[model samples]
Target chain A: MAQIRMETNLLGANDMLAAKNRRIFKARGLLVINLMSSPGSGKTTLLEKTIEALRGRIELGVIEGDLYTDQDAMRIENKGVEVVQINTEGTCHLDAGMIEKAWSRLEHLPIQLLFIENVGNLVCPAEFDLGEDIRVVVLSTTEGHDKVLKYPLVFQQAQVVVLNKIDLLPYTDFDLNAFNRDLQLVNPQIRVFQLSGRTGEGLAQWTEWLVEEVGKRVI
Target chain B: MHEMSLIAEMMNMVRESAAHNNITRISRIKLVVGKLTMAMPHSLRFAFHTMARDGLFQGTELLIEEREVAYQCCQCGEKYLPDMPYGQLCPNCGSKASHLLSGRELFVEYYEGDSGKGEENGANTHGN
Candidate 1:
């Protein structure tokens, strides 16, 4: 028997769909963001705050990925943005095909930005690309500094790292300097925004950065 | 786990390639897994063993190779191996290089299987 040489990516099918989604997004001049983080990292709250900040500056739509209910989708809908909820049942992450289906609902909404809030898991979500223009990983200050080092794969791919719940830093042992150093090791050029979803401290910097990113891609 | 789904795809690939190349039974399969991925070998093996019980793929030997993460220096334009397994520091120029040369891969490399022209022992699909 001879050895057949074939280099086949296991995620090739999903990646093909992701490429198609990217092309579709580009043709429509829309920017999609895949927001990821661990459970209890306050990603929903961060999105709420972000939606409030960019209400009039840029039109927004969201596709919320969760295992069970449409809780986050409801939260996003309360912010006056069109939202779609995808229940993965028990899947740990969201794939490009899910986004492809979700986009159909918001296809004619005249929105400029789409946020795919991936299921709250650090490991699996990083493995799949959902045809997003930007990837952001939200890590709250209470999660500790070792998260950047432990979950390097997720942090490395993120263009922006959101350090939320800074207002609670006083009660937690989370070290910002150490966290930055770890993040630098993973990705030296990662843009970091230290903010609080509850107190709104440092929200302006994050919102300004978001607006700038949208402005850069809006055609 | 995602590995389960990925392994299912790998099995499909093996079958399709076998049917295309006129092979009946695949005996050995080789896969290259990256260091940055969260796939544990045991999990993949379990998934493979459990799924290979089907008629298309049975008792297939799976070989997995773990790859190390490498980074390319942006300053000196050189690719140097880092001291540790997962850091992005450029060992050559000591710069904060953003280009990741390797270590985000998960793919099937090679496989050996039963071809046609013999006594047609389970390889009759080849139609020799």
Candidate 2:
């Protein structure tokens, strides 16, 4: 029997493409954000609010990843932003390769802030890095506070968390203290913005932070 | 599950290596998976079996080495192992500035296979 030593990463190909994407974004001075969440976490609504708040101020573009339909992409496009849709068919996550293919179509557009709305999956999407400047996870109050502990990887890797559906916080049993404590344990440095997409409450803070990020990335 | 895709990538790597070294009928494959990867070993094993049904990977045994989440406290400069991904706070100094050192490993370490010229009955034909 012959033993062949091949110590290599399983996601080496994906990581390499991610590095390439990072380089491209850096050269273009584009602030890329990978938005992740569960299916019903109000990610699309958050994007729509962000677009309304930052439109004409920052050149914004979006790449929407969905399982089959381009519903989210149409929503973003209706907000007057150039949106590209990538239907992964049945894949749960958007890898670097998919992002690369999507970005090629949007590279010519005047985009300074690019948001890649990843497939609404907390697990698989966290494993594949799409070479974004920031990783944001949107968690709704309806999703429960235990999500941080149940899916620690997604929270641990995220730089920011948008606590969406805050207007419904009074209606649900989502404990804010427990959520903050769990998130603190998982990611101590994570910045969180509590906002409701339906009512547009507490959205200025989120959009302001995004504008600041885009400003910092601009040359 | 995404484990199927992970196994498919592993098979691609194994096939390339086998072609390069002229290995046939791979018998053993070793993998290192970290706890922070969130990839369950049982699921990975099931994926391997389902994907390796035929071809050069048929009848292969998979060996997995699971690694715990390791972190280093940035403030106190102390190394520690967290029981869970959320338990990353430094125990010695109660600091939250913990940097993950080695917990996200997911890789194929090595594999053992038989060359067509080697002994068929597990006899040591090549020098160890």
Candidate 3:
């Protein structure tokens, strides 16, 4: 029988690269947010709305991650903002190495706020650290309320939870109170904002929070 | 799953270290996982077993050491462990202003196996 002896972390390589990315962000004084959610959860819509609202106020850039297609990147670029598209090429999530590669292309832009739209998968995205100032998880009313309970790790790791597509609340049976309770049970410290990106309802609160958070990191 | 990617990285590290020291066989591996991280021991083991085959870690024992979450209250200076399934108020000071001290860690502490000498007994090595 062959014998092997070792002591090493499964995430050691990812963590090392993440730390390097964090150092670069810190050096640039950039406020990076890793945005995560399930498919069709309005991440790109919210980004469009956010860019529109804070275009002149904050220098913004984006890194769009998806399994395939540069559709989201095209949408962001149409808004006249700096953006990079990363096709995970069938992978479910984006890692620090992928972000680092994207940064090489977009880092030359004058950006103060960087948004990384992670691939829409709740489980895998929560595991990798992308060296962001905040990890925001987006949840839409159409996806139901049990998501917070079933995926506690995402909620626990997130600093903020954005409840998108609130305009459709009238048509869907989404219990806001129950969702809040479940979210708090998972992470009491998480700041949650319920908003609709399509109609612009409740976008002010999210933008305000983003402004405040970004303000704190600016030199 | 991301576990597969992580396992591949771990095996790479083991192989590099073994080659550097001129060691041929390994017996056991020890790793510490924090409760706050999303890593599952069962899933990690399954993935490790699948990836370690035909590698330097081929018949190695996977040993996992769990580290619980410890928080200290910013107001009252109280320290305690939160309940499993996590996210409960601090029982000691009833303050939510607690700072996390541990449970975010993921690393290897040490290993016990051959010393590359013809003699089978040697001192164990630890890596940070």
What TM-score number comes out for model 2?
0.93
DockQ score of the complex predicted as candidate 3: 0.28
Q: What is the per-residue lDDT of model 2 for residues A1-219, given as tens digits with 9 covering 90 to 100?
A: 777777899999899999999999999999999999999999999999899998779999899999999888899988889999999888888999999999999999989999999999888899898899999999999999999999999998999999999999999999999999988889988999999999999999999998889889888
Off by over 4 Å in 2: B83-85, B119-128
Q: Candidate order by lDDT, highest to lowest?
A: 2, 1, 3
Q: Tens digits of per-residue lDDT for model 3 on A1-219?
A: 223344456676777899999999988989999999999999999999999999789999999999899999999999999999999887778999999999999888889999999999898898899888899999999999988877777898899999999999988989989898777766888998989999999999999988998888877
What TM-score does chain A reach in every model? 0.97, 0.98, 0.97
lDDT of 1 by residue, A1-219 (tens): 656777888899899999999999988888899999999999999889889989888899999999999989999999999999999998888999999999999998988889999999888899999999999999998889998888889988899998999999999999888888888888888998989989999999988887887788777
Tens digit of per-residue lDDT, candidate 1, span B44-97: 999899889865467689999988777778788878666744777776667876
Model 1 residue A187 lDDT score = 83
Candidate 3: clashing pairs of residues: A3-B26, A4-B26, A4-B27, A5-B26, A5-B27
Using all chains and alpha carbons, the TM-scores for the candidates as numbered come to 0.91, 0.93, 0.83
DockQ for every model, please: 0.45, 0.48, 0.28
- Candidate 1 pairs with clashing backbones: none
A55 in model 1: Cα distance from truth in Å?
A: 2.3
Give model 2's docking category. acceptable
